[model samples]
Target: MNLNKAWGILKENGFKETTKRNQILEIFEGDERYLTARDILDVMQKDYPSMSYDTVYRNLATFVSLDILEATELSGEKHFRMHCESDHHHHHFICMDCGKIKEIPLCPMDLLGAALPAYEIDNHKFEIYGKCPECK
Candidate 1:
């Protein structure tokens, strides 16, 4: 995504666009993979040498909060990916070795919700992990 699209997304969420935010978004612009804070920092620090760890973390939290990004905790570390909501809700099968993502056709919670009507469901996150074709 270009700077304009990034700005547009931020504006749609009522967030003011900034250099740092754009730089952060650029890291995932054309990539469809999970990235850790350190992974992002390594790429960002090349241009933004003064960027701090806290700044990357804060921006990540903001992106996740704004629904522009999704975070999944894997192996005790949080990994982030761009979020694009489709008409039908689904989950993902994430390749642990390559960070490749494959969309799951159905959500398990839908069936669970039907089975447990009394439970009030607020949110859900699902990710399956394994090796990708190339990795295998």
Candidate 2:
């Protein structure tokens, strides 16, 4: 993902580019899977010895508000995922047993989109729960 474009979006939303924010963005840029605040904190502490958990959490909220990132809640816990709409818009299927999240390409939208008016509907997200292959 382009960190520069994400940073520009943040700046346009009145967020300053602080060192903590930069570090958080760096982590997001490197992540290939969905990450939670706790996951980011653990990773950040290893790379940035002086970084605080609160700093990571705060920056996460800012990024979400700026629409540079997105948050998903599963079983009462939150997960953060990149919001690069240009990549692909899809939903997720999570394994409750193993805490694994799998991306599922959107198939139903094509059928529904033909029936609904654009302005009448805003956006959507779907999540399915079951044991993943390994867990099952």
Candidate 3:
């Protein structure tokens, strides 16, 4: 949610307290947009010259594994968003024509959770494809 909270989560996940990691959190905090490895690396490059793309990727993977972030595929690229512990879970909407991604509030599971009697569904993903408002 906030920088201090994010730092605590990373620390609990065994992430060392470093300037690079702090900067990464800052970037996410400042923008609500979901970011891919390239997006993050590009921003990091502005402030941190020694930061490598590989390192950014690795750190993002670790954050996802630790449940500190959510990874989604939008517009054919992977994106990461910080998972605020108290926030309600939701899905995404992607515009196929203009490459716009928006967070959709409804969780379809509320409607389908009872129908899944034959199989165990640990988790599910729902993405609706269409033109976004601006693209339309």
Candidate 4:
């Protein structure tokens, strides 16, 4: 999502604009890779030396709750990226080395659903992790 849309969502949800929040959003703007809290902290510390992990994590939680960002576990730690702007449903292939994401248009559920015909499935998330070509 774009910064303006993110701001609009915040406004619609009765959130006031703040410099820190804007900066957080800017970090994800135009970047299509997932970022860890440490990654954010590294960038933020340059501008606000006193920034704490708690503060960055709190905002990350807020963004995820608001659906402005998407979260995933990478190498046992949580990473986040801006919500996908695609109009179609899809999953992703994440690069382990670079954090780059490639959209996967095929849904594995199509095959899995057939195998679990007796059970009801509510939802699912499928992601493939590997090195991207450049990283290789």
Candidate 5:
């Protein structure tokens, strides 16, 4: 999502805008890759030398809960990226090495649903993780 839309969501949710929050959003705005807390802290430290990990993590959690960011686990650590702007149903292919993401325009549930006719599924998330072409 764009900065304006992100700010609007924050306001709608009664969240106050802050310089740190704006900087966090800017970090994710133009990037398609996921970033870990450490990755973000490194950049944020440049501007806010006294920033703590707790503060960075708190904001990340807030963003995820607000749907402004999406989270995933890779190599046993959580990584985050801005929520996709697509209005259509889709999944993703994530690069294990570089944190890059590629949109997958297909859903596997179509076939998985057929295989499990006895069960009802309400929701699901699908992502394939591997090295992207450039990383490979």
Candidate 6:
């Protein structure tokens, strides 16, 4: 019936060619930022008359499940952005003004001296935030 899976993917940009999915992808492409659910729905409404909040949430959930999107919290709200990973250990520098991600090839742990005593360190996250070159 060409209902949900109507769009044929042209490449490996973590998106199918469907109208709705493509629209969502275009939003991310236009601005690589951490988008909240409302942000996505607001942008999609301009192009899709029948699009709903639930639909947007569902699609976002799918993307997160597939690891194509990363959901994180900022201030007190949750946002989503494209997921990029390398085969090695590294970090990212995010532009606070514009959510552009830049890879940092160094690990902070390497410069440290063990786990600061017995603190039960399970995992850690590292990200630097500032304006990007374009934004600057």
Select the stronger candidate by lDDT from 5 and 6. 5
Model 2 CA lDDT for position 48: 79
Model-by-model lDDT, in order? 0.82, 0.76, 0.78, 0.91, 0.91, 0.72
On TM-score, the candidate that comes out on top is 4
Give candidate 1's TM-score: 0.87
TM-score of each: 0.87, 0.68, 0.79, 0.91, 0.90, 0.68
Tens-place lDDT per residue, model 4, 61-92, is 98999989999987789999999999778899
Candidate that beats the other on lDDT, 2 or 6, i.e. the better one:
2
Residues 15-134 of candidate 6 have per-residue lDDT tens digits of 545678777766765566788999999988888877899988988887777666677766687788766546577778878887777889998887765858776767778878899999
TM-score sort, best first: 4, 5, 1, 3, 2, 6
List where candidate 2 sits over 4 angstroms from the true fold.
87-89, 94-124, 129-136
C-alpha lDDT (0 to 100) for residue 16 of candidate 4: 84
- Please give, for residues 11-102, the per-residue lDDT of candidate 5 as tens digits: 99999999999999999997889999999999999999998999899999999999899898877899999999998888899998888999
Off by over 4 Å in 5: 117-123
Q: Mind giving the per-residue lDDT tens digits that candidate 1 earns over 33-117?
A: 8999999899889998988999899989988886678888989999998885565788888898889788898988867857867
Q: Supply candidate 5's per-residue lDDT for 14.
A: 98
Error of 3 at 60 (Å): 0.5
What candidate 6 gets wrong by more than 4 Å, as runs, is 1-18, 110-122
lDDT of 3 at 66: 72
Clashes of each: 0, 0, 0, 0, 0, 1
Error of 4 at 45 (Å): 1.0
Q: How does residue 82 of candidate 3 score in lDDT?
A: 75
